[model samples]
Target: MANKIVVPIKQVPETKSVKMDEKTGTVIREGVDSIVNPLDLYAIEAALRLRDRYGGEIVGISMGPKKSVKALKEAVSMGVDSAILLSDRAFAGSDTWATSLILASAIRKIGDFGLVVCGERATDGDTGQVGPGIASFLGIPALTYVSRIQDLSDKLCRAERLIEDGREILETSLPAVLTVIKEAGEPRLPTLRGKKRAKDLDVQIWGNDELGIDPDKIGLKGSPTRVVKIYRPKVARKCTIAEAKDEASVGPAVDRMCGFLADKGVLQ
Candidate 1:
């Protein structure tokens, strides 16, 4: 098997509580509870399973604020051999495309990896673009919605992917990237020993300087997609309460209610 595998992970604000910064066009993370993107846990599990079967090093990598280090630590606790954090003010406000570039650069710096795994999508973004973007940046083959792996060797791997109509089996060369669906499997909880090791092991932090990424290819400055404006669409509803005067009038009341609903374009 290849010597190394990289799993790209993300930490996102809880879906129910996520807020965006209108001024900056970025997520407002302060005072929000964050968790590793649920889908990414499956990717991590897939990496761990691959290592178990193929004998390779597994590394978890993420690009986010310093708080993201916590996500990486969690991955280490889940049996990742090591973790890397990409953090810097220069990386703030990156969209999926720029984020992928930064991550692909970091992976390139890490060198010699046979596989890269990532979640099908991030809860906060729901764009499902980063994985393929990373593959594009790295110039490698990529597979999305992978649900099962049939075989894995040092130079090649084969897997089943879920598609719109059904599923398809695919085989690809090594050094490939796979974006895994949650249906692939559940992630294992961290063992006590793994937790202790995670606490003791320092996660290496890399920045633009370390990865030598071009300033024009990272952060808000590099993001091609822009949020020109963000506003809550107003919701307007007119409520008409109908009450029947008595059983004798119930039929008339029902007719009136239906008429009101029809006037409101709620019924035919």
Candidate 2:
């Protein structure tokens, strides 16, 4: 049997278009369009490349509302063999820790896996904790910020990791997890055949009961973090728009702009 590599993905609202509900402090998804988390695409691509070279199955997993099926289908179009979605009211309001626990349970139910790949972070939270959190829950070695995969065999996997100051090369055995960085590479586009196959692929939907997850460890009660408040930062800078108003006034406008910058300590 070929090794099975699982990739966990998320559907996030387009950052620029996201609107927050001031009363509930939650994202307003009504008008906001959602897309697959960009970083996770790199992870998916990495898994696809490995499958091409080593021969294995790639499975995409996601935890969200039913609408997230779009994200899973998108993964299918990217060549994932199959996909799974974990959805239920029980999963609502889960923090990173709770989310990872749920994902770990689903992975266990899969019964067999050689590797797990994930994006470094989600654009919404930007905490960059879930990937490592999943590895910790599974008790597997996790190589994060991976920019390049040097080797991947049945027994071993080697990759180069990007850090703040420099890069580090790491080698871990199979059954490990990797959280890839954007430096890895751009993801491949879905082909027409892949899209056709995606439409026919039956995506499995699992819930807390299906995975036998504990109710106490799933929803709001299971989450450790709480939002205190949500508000946009105040803009404190004063702006003065200067216009020449006429061709002959251009020189004066330039002089005025230089004076304003100098007064603001932007120029010496």
Q: Ten-residue segment with the worst summed lDDT in candidate 1?
A: 234-243
Candidate 2, residue 265: the lDDT equals 100
- TM-score, structure 1 vs. true: 0.92
Q: Per-residue alpha-carbon lDDT of model 2 for 36-90, expressed as tens digits?
A: 9999999999999888888889999999988888899999998999999999899
Residue 195, candidate 1: alpha-carbon lDDT: 92
lDDT, residue 23, model 2: 65
**For this target, which candidate reaches the highest TM-score against the unseen true structure?**
1
Q: List the RMSD of every prediction in angstroms.
A: 2.5, 2.3
Off by over 4 Å in 2: 236-243, 247-259, 265-268
lDDT per residue as tens, model 1, 41-143: 9999999998888787998999988889999999999999999999999999999899999999999999989889999999999999999999999999999
Spell out the clash pairs found in candidate 1. none
lDDT of 1: 0.92
Clashing pairs in 2: none
